[model samples]
Target: MEYVAGNVANKAGVRLLMACLLAKLHNPLVDVRKPYTRIGGSDSFSGRKYDERYIADFINANALPCNSTSAFLTPAFRNRNAPLVMGLELEGRPPQLYTYVLELLDDVHNRRVEPENLLAEIIRWLLINRNEQQQRIESLLKTLRTTHGAIPLSSEAIVGLIEKHMSLKGTSRIPVLIVAAAYQAAGQYLLEMNLPLQAHNAADVQTGALGDVEITFVGDGKVVTSYEMKDRHVTRGDIDRALQKLEETRKRVDNYIFITTDRIDEQVQDYARSLYTQTDGIEFVILDCIGFLRHYLHLFHRVRTEFLEAYQSLLLAEPSSSVSQAVKEAFLSMRHATEAG
Candidate 1:
C-alpha cells in the first residue's frame, strides 16, 4: 500500500526547519545613531538644567512624556527619528503655535509681522532645543544644493529657486545636473588613474545642440584611452553623431570608450556589435550612473580627505594664480591616471 504524507504534516515540517535555521542565523545589529554621530556629537542637550524646563514644556505642550529623569541620561537619539516625531506633532497641533503667530500678524491692520522678530524666534527655537528636525532640514538643504543643483528654503520655494538659478523648466534641469554630476565623478575617477589626459570637457558639436558629449581625457601626445560620456536620454541620432566624431578622432587616440548614464539602447548595442564584427579595434562600453554613483561615493570621501590635505599645504605655499592652477592640474592628472587603470 502506498501512503502519502499529510499536507499539514509536510507544511509543519517545513516551518519547523525554517524556524530552526532562523534561530541559528546571526541577528544583525544596526546602529541608528551612526549618521548623526558622523555629523555631530550624539549627546542630546535636552537634559541640561537650562534646557530641562524648555524641553519639559515642549514635550508637555505636545503631550509627550519624559520617561527619563535626566535628559543627559537619555540615550543618544537618532536624528531622523526625532525630527519625524516633531514634524508629526507640529503638524497635528497647528493651532497651538504656528496658527497663533499667524492670527497675531493678521490682527495687525496696517502692520506686518516684523521680519526680524519672526526670524529671531525661528532661530531661537532651532537653537534652544537643538531641534533635530531643524538640523536635519538644514542638512537636507545643503545636500540638495550640491546634489539637486540648488537649494530651496522650503518645498514651496523649489519653483522660485529653479526659475532663478536653472532657467530650465520642469525636470529638464534635474537630469542635466544629474548627468553633469555623473560625468564629473567619472572624469575625476579617470583622472585619479593617471591617464595621459588634461581635463574633462563637454562641448556642443553643433549650434542649437541640446545634446552634448563630455570627453574626460583627450589623448595626450602619448596614446591612451579616450572616453565619451552620454546620458540615458541620448537618441539614435546622438549615437550616430558620437560615432562619426569618434571615427574622425580615433586616429589621434589609442582606444575609445563609450560611457552612458543608462543602459545602451538596442540600436547602440547593434552598432557596437557591428564594430566588433568589423574588427574596427575601437572598444565600446556603457557605464550606468547608478553604478558610477556607488563607486564614486566612496571615492569622494577619499578625495575630500586628499583635497583637505592639499588645501592646507597651499596655505604654506606662495600665493600665485599659476601655482594654484598647477596644483589643480596635478591633482586632476593624478585622478585621471587612477581612473583609467
Candidate 2:
C-alpha cells in the first residue's frame, strides 16, 4: 500500500500487480500465488497462456490504454516455461513496488503465509484502489463544475495551461488528450462547419477502430475523416501501413490526418500530399501537435472557452493509467494559477 501511494503515478506497476492477483483469484485451479510463481509446463500450467487470456482483458475492463510502456506489454509474464525463480530474479522492474510484491509472494511460496488468505486480501486491495480512483475523478469533476462558484478559465489561459502540461516531465498523456478533447469540444462547432465528429477516445488496437479520432455525421456508419496521433516523425512506411488499413477497412475516408508531436518530415509531407491523386482524393495532412491546436483554436475562437471546458472534462475523465494523479493535480494547480493571474 505504501509503495502504491508513493508511486501512484506509475499505474503500470499497479495494474501489473493487480492483473497477476486477479489471474490467480479468477483461476483457483492454478496453484500459484501469482503469474510469476506459476510453472511453465503442460496446458494446465503455462503462466504465459494464463496471462495472454486475462491481462489485456483486465486492462480493458478497467479502461487502461494498454500502452507499450505498461507492464502489460512486457513479455516477462508470458514466460510459460519459467517458474518461481522468475519472480525471485525478475529484473528491470519499476522501483519499490516490485520489491514489495516480491516479498509478499516469497512469504506465500515459503509457507510463511497462506495463499488463500493473501488472495482474499488482494481482492480487497483491488476494491480499495477502485474507490480511491473514483474519489480522485469525482474531485476533478467537481473542480470543473462552475456551480461551486469557482471562476472558469479563460480560453487563452487554458491554452497556456495545455502548453505547460505538454512540457511537464512524465506526462506524455497530454498530447493525446488535446486531440481527444478538441474533438469532444467541437461537437456543435464541427456540426456548424458541416463536419460532425464521432468523438471516441482512442481505444487500443484491440477495439478495431480505423484510427485514433474518427469524424462522421450522426446516424452515418461511414467515417469521413480520421486522425491518428503519432509521437514520432511521420514516415512513408507509416503512411503505407495507414493506406493498408484504409484498404482493409474499405470505409472510404475523405480526410486522414496525422497529428505528430515530432517535427514534420518535409520529404514525407511531399510524399503524403502527392498521394491525393493515387488514393482517389484521400487527402493526407501532417501537422505538429501545437500547430494543430493553433489551427483548431483559431477556427473555433468564438467558443474557445467551450473547448477549454471540454478539454478539462476529457482530461479528468482519463484513468490514472493514462493520466497520473500528479498530472491531474498539476492541471488543477495550473488552472488555479491561471485564475489568479
Candidate 3:
C-alpha cells in the first residue's frame, strides 16, 4: 500500500508490484510472488505475454487513470525477493518510494501494526483522497461551464481573486501560478522589455534550471532573471542554498528573485541585499508573492483580463500533484463570483 501510494505519478514498477501481492494473497504458494519467477505456467502463460508491452493502452481501455506496466525491466525489480533488494531496488524516479514501502512492510512484520487494520486504514485514506478529488473535478467542470463572475478587470479585483486561491491551504504550488500567469499574459509586454519568458517549470519537475521561472535573453538563451518560489518565509539558509545552486550551475544571471507567500525577514533581506555588490551586480532579492502579482497586474493594467485568463489556464493545466483538483475548482468558483460584467 505504501508502495502503491508513493508511486503516484511514476508508475513504472507498480502494476507488477500489486499484481504479485495479489497473487500471493490469492495463493500463498504461487511462484508469481517473485518478480523473476520463471515458473513455466506462471505469469507469461496465465496472464498477458510480452514483457515490453506498454500499460498506457490498458489504462485507456479501462477508461481509468490506473497505470499497470511490467516491472521486469525496471532497475532493481529482480531484487524484490532478496532481503537487500528492498526499496532502492524498485524504482529510481522517486528515490524514497521503495524505502517508504519497506518501512510500511517493516511495521507489519514487527507487529507494530496489524496488517488488516493498516490495510483498512490505507483503503479509507485512498478512498477519501479519490472521492475528494472527484468531487473537486466535478465541481470545477460545473464552474468551467458557466460564466461565474465578471471577468477580473482591476488590479485590486484580480489581487482579491488570487488571494482566494492562495488562502487554499495545502496548495503550496498555487503561488507559482501567479508568477507564471504574469509572465504568460505579459508575453508581449515582456518581449517589449526584452525579457523573453520561458515556460514555468512544473513544481515536481527538475529541468536543471536555477529557479521555478527563468527569463532568458532572445539571442543568447542565457537566463537574464531567475525566480525561485517559496510558500513560506525566506531564510538565510535558503539564501545559502540559492548561492550554492548558482555556484554549482556556474550560471550568471543579472537578477535572481525569491518569491514567497510569507513575511520577509529583515536580516534575510539585508543578506540578500548584500549579494548585489558581493556578486558583482547580480541582484538577489526577495519579494512578496501577492505583492509581486499585484504590481505586475497594475503595471500592465491593460492586460488585466489576459492575466486572469492566463491564471485560469494555469490552474487547469497544472498536474494534480502540483495543484490539487479542489484548488483548481476553488479558483474557478472565485472567478465566477468576482465578476461584475
Instruction: Point to the candidate with the largest TM-score.
Output: 2
Q: lDDT by residue for model 2 over 1-341, one digit each (tens)?
A: 44642355344444455455555556645545445444443313434444456665665576443332335345434344344332455444474666666666566556676666665565466556666766776775566453435555555666677888877765666666677677667866565122322233434345556677677765565678877878779899989888988887666788888888789889999999999999999999898888778778878777677777777776776665566666776777677566656
Residues 1-341 of candidate 1: C-alpha lDDT, one tens digit per residue: 00000121111111111111122221212111111223334421221332244433543454221221222232322222331121232222222432332233232212353333433443344333334433543554344334332221232222223223222222222223333443443445665222221112224443222133333343433434444555454455655665676555544333444556556677666665555434356555455534543444445544433332332233213121112222323333333333232
RMSD of candidates 1 onward, in order:
25.8, 4.5, 9.2
* lDDT, residue 122, candidate 3: 49
- Model 3: per-residue lDDT, tens digit, 1-341? 64554345554444444444444344545433233444444432221222334333543343322333344445645433333233434546676665655565556445676545655554455456556666777776676557645344578988987887788875777776777777777867576222422343322135567887777644457778888888889999988888888888888888889999999999999999998888889999999988898888889999888888877877776645456555777777776666633
162 in model 3: Cα distance from truth in Å?
A: 1.3
Worst 10-residue lDDT window, candidate 2: 192-201
Pairs in steric clash, model 3: 87-98, 148-336, 149-336, 149-339, 150-339, 150-340
Q: Which ten residues in a row have the lowest lDDT in candidate 3?
A: 43-52
Q: Model 1's lDDT to the true fold?
A: 0.33
Question: Measured by TM-score, how close is model 1 to the native structure?
Answer: 0.28
Residue pairs whose backbone atoms clash in candidate 2 = 40-80
Model 3 compared with the native: what TM-score? 0.63
Candidates' TM-scores? 0.28, 0.78, 0.63
